[model samples]
Target chain A: MLSVNVRLFGTLSRTFEDYHHSCGLDIAIASRGDIHDLLVHLDLIGESIGMVFMDDKQVNNTTKLNDNARIKIFQPIFGG
Target chain B: MNIVRVDMNARKITREIFEPAFTGMGGRGLTSFFINREVPPGCDPLGPDNKLVFAPGFFSGSTLVNTSRFSIGAKSPMTRGIKESNVGGTVAADMARTGISAIIVEGRPNNGQSFILKVDQKGDVTLHDADQYWGKRTYDLVASIKEFYGNKISITCIGPAGEQQLSAASIQATDRDGRPCRAAGRGGLGAVMGSKGLKALIIEKSATNAEPIQDLEGFKASAKIFAKAVMDDEFSAEILPELGSAVLVEPINAAGAFPTRNAREGQFEDADKISGEALAQIIKSRGGKPNHKGCSGCIINCSNEYVDEKGEFITSSLEYETIWSMGGMIGNNDLDSIARLDRLCDDIGLDTMSTGVAVAVAMDAGYKEFGDAKAAIEMVEDVARGTAFGKILGHGPEMVGKHFNHDRVPVVKGQSIAAYDPRAIQGMAVTYSTSPMGADHTAGWVVDSNLEAFGGTLDPFSAQGQVENSRNTQIHMAMVDTVGICDFAQTGFGAPDGLENVCKMIAAKSGKPFCEADWKSTGKMIIQTELEFNKNAGFTKEQDRLPRMFYEEPLPPHNKVVVIQDDDMDSTFAF
Candidate 1:
């Protein structure tokens, strides 16, 4: 099993507050799992997660996940 | 589109035809062009020679979303430079529907009597004495006018701060709910309006149709595509309309870029307490508007009607910057207090950001204690009352810093910096230092996506590639402002084809040739005009750099200082 540290941003914290407490949630995934698998496991609104950053770099939904990968999800936010 | 010129000194008004020289120009484009052409560089901002021009954007009055941006221009009493402050509300759309492209108020009244400029339903302009309304709070004044013009009227006015000719005053505009929450704030343009003896500009809801589009079918197709893209974006659809602008508090805080306690710290411990998530929770429990439409045609709906504990409306749009400025910057964690301060700013007609920074500077200098919510409210009320102490606080951060002899004044060219700490986001340092508007965030905002989308490769902690990044974003934003697109629509504009569609809409509307190629060139033209205006007003390379405190003080969390060099700033206008 591979584990990734994930933090949700904006409305995501509220959506997944039961699991994450605030914004961060630690999840274990199968070997070579991608962002799709993570989103499925979390059961978050798929379209709402516009950008996914794996270790401070942008990645797509199909990008491969590795052991202990740091992930942060951002919704589309403008204005301030 | 006609230009209505009101000569206050002679008590005469004239309607002149919009010139071909300023054709295809609206909003900041027209205001800046007209100011640079007419107003002398060295004239006093509050003098008769300095004119106050208000013009709506190109797509205003049209069936366009997010085109209700009003550009108010003048020689700034705060920065002593040509300034154009953009506001969002129903005023821009309603004023544009009057078939008047711009309202230019010139000269000064001898007796210094207050007056209101009214444009009726039939496109007629008249001046009315404002003796009863003068010195009143903007919200009350707006309500008084609403009684006369009824609900369909849109108003742009100032409060006692402007009446007292404070340099930090902002001209407040009525939002969709007739609340004076939308403001053309920054650069003391309100003082110019006050100087002209004008209290407010009341526009009756017009019966006229949208601006004539040259290629109607083509424009419709392009506009449909653009509107669909904006409305379809995940951020626009889910985050903005749901949580409003305050939602930015978390992501920015998580990224270690949220400025706190006057930029002494990069991240605040109480960030979540004053965040959009918490704000939403509070609004839910209090049972007020969770997501309110701020402007006339704002599809994003990124503003909220904040309510008190009793579930009464206190203010509209307690946005991220305002939350950060009034909350973390002053070390105050109370969201309700911050909401009240936002309300005070709207009512008193002052820049919330400037007012916050000023209070922060004063607190740092021992005028008040940090985290003292009562003291913060008192300080703000001082500005409203026009007291001697209030006058110091009303002069904005730089002057307060000078008065208290405190060195850590976070300002660029006299205007206060926004919520983002420059040290954490080095690209913002470039934007704040070199933007012709002086420390304005809207000139160009750099989030993580902005770096990747614009092809900018830079270490945000260090100085590499930041100058280029700032230059590119600044130029692109200039085009957006000139063409009258809202920054929130960047969810669409940031897409590969997003900005192209924006240019397409403009080209279709005016029958002009503009695409991505012209985007950068058009932005350059507008920026050059602004830079020329600033240059003539005695701003040189020295004024184009960030304050020394930003360079010396190391912000916590990342512990990075603003390392962008002055040499890089000199090249910002090299284009």
Candidate 2:
């Protein structure tokens, strides 16, 4: 199992009342787990997440997660 | 619908039916077509030969949601090119309800006099003396006008910056609350109004006289479908209303395209502090209203009222662009100072993007230290005070860069680039370099489609497929602006039957057959007219290129320069 750091942004932060913005939530996932598995593990599978970033790089659902990877999840952003 | 012509030189007003050539055109379509046909291309932008036009979107007076987009267009003193800046407010709906399509201001006043134009609910047009209101700021001017005309009228006016003919000046339009907060804040159209010696326009509100729909039943049906589509889109219905446009701060910064510290850095260290989430939290804690409606008939309500710690009004509708401009661009993390600067720009009638970029250029040239919020506030105040340095800043970033001999200025044809840096998002590079509107983000927003995490297919760092994408997007936006649809409300077009429903509405209004192909053709026509106008105004292919910094400098994080070829950029308008 690999422990990865995850930060939830916008309204997603409110879902976890104990979540702190500066201190990201850490979750253990299977060594071969990908973004999809992580979403299922975090119970955000059906949530409205606009974008997901791993190590500051945009990643897709099938992208593999690495140990200590920095993950950031954001809601939809409407640019003017 | 009728077009009103105000001849300032003769102090005359005339009403005329639309010529067959100009029928079925409104908003940007009418403004660009009229300027291309009547105004001399090579004339000085602020001279008498130049014309200023105010037009509403085609669906303004209808029962549609969020269609009150009003376009103000002219040859811009800042870019020396054709420009259109649209604002969302009650004015468009009010003018449309009065059965007016466009108001054309022609020929500057010969005598050194100022005047105000009034359009009554009965559609009668009159010119009044505005000597007493000539130098008043937009807020005070709107207040005075509303006091005299009752609270029912909408006033589109300029501030002292416009009277000074500053290139960064903007035309301020009153929102639904009768506050002059919504702004046509690009292209320096306010200077053109000032050059014409026009102070304000008081348009009487009307509950009757909406543009007659030939097939009212059909129009209503299509409008219902379109409105539902907008409401169904998660971005429009949920995200925007909850977080406002400032929600972009996190995603854009995460994508490494936020354009922080004058484009030297792609991400701001304090981005989280001035982000949309922080803004909403602050507003809620301070008793400010979020999810507020600033435009008429707007259901999404992406606007907000920012108040001070004491719960006093600071400004209404603190937007994403302004937050990026005053926060990350100048390296200021203080949201309070940014809100104050936003209010000052609104009151003084200046473009916050241009003004902020000008200050950033000055700070980059060592005129002041970066992150000095007080200095940033004072420089913007200087433009309002008309200080010697203020006049230079009001001319925008290019002038400030030249004054300080700085080569890192991020401008295309004198207009400052918006929040998005082109190096990180190559599609934006193509859009900024090729757009006739001069680095305007709204001209072609390919940001979302270029970021892979956001379900975008295009590679943000690649040149392949960027030109074609930008060209199509620009064409679509030209027609979107032509029809006067708010960009936010355009989530409707993403629905399964969105385009078809909109076509039905257009066909219902014109009593003519319309389809998607006609939409493309109309957009293409508008752009072709603008490109021709720019060419005749002495612009060449060289003017359709980005500044050297974007090509040479490697922005932090991504460290990628604009990779789009010049040939690709020139081919963007080949259609």
Query: What is every candidate's C-alpha DockQ against the true complex, given to 2 decimals?
Result: 0.33, 0.61
Cα deviation of A11, candidate 1, in Å: 2.9
Model 1 regions lying over 4 Å from their true place? A1-7, A13-40, A43-73, A76-80, B20-23, B449-456, B494-496
Model 1: DockQ vs. true structure: 0.33
Worst ten in a row by lDDT for model 2 chain B = B17-26
Every model: iRMSD: 3.8, 1.8
lDDT of 2 by residue, B1-56 (tens): 58999999999899898853533578899899888888898999999999999999
Best-fitting candidate, measured by TM-score? 2
Best by DockQ: 2
- Residue-level lDDT of model 1, residues B1-575, one tens digit each, is 58899999988999988663423578888888888888998899999999999998888877767889899999898888878899998988898888888989999999978899998877799999888899899989988988876888899999988887888999999888888899888988888888988999999886484467888888777777777888777678777877788888866765567877777888788987897878987997899887888898888888898899899999998888889889989999999999999999889999999999998898888888889989999999999888888998888998899899998898988999998888888988999999998899888786553434223356778787788877888888776777677778766664457777777778887787767777777677778888898899888888887888789988877788988878887887887
Give Cα distance to truth, residue B212, candidate 1, Å.
1.8
Given candidate 2, what's the lDDT at residue B288? 94
Is model 2 an incorrect, acceptable, medium or high docking prediction?
Answer: medium
lDDT scores of the candidates, listed in order: 0.83, 0.88
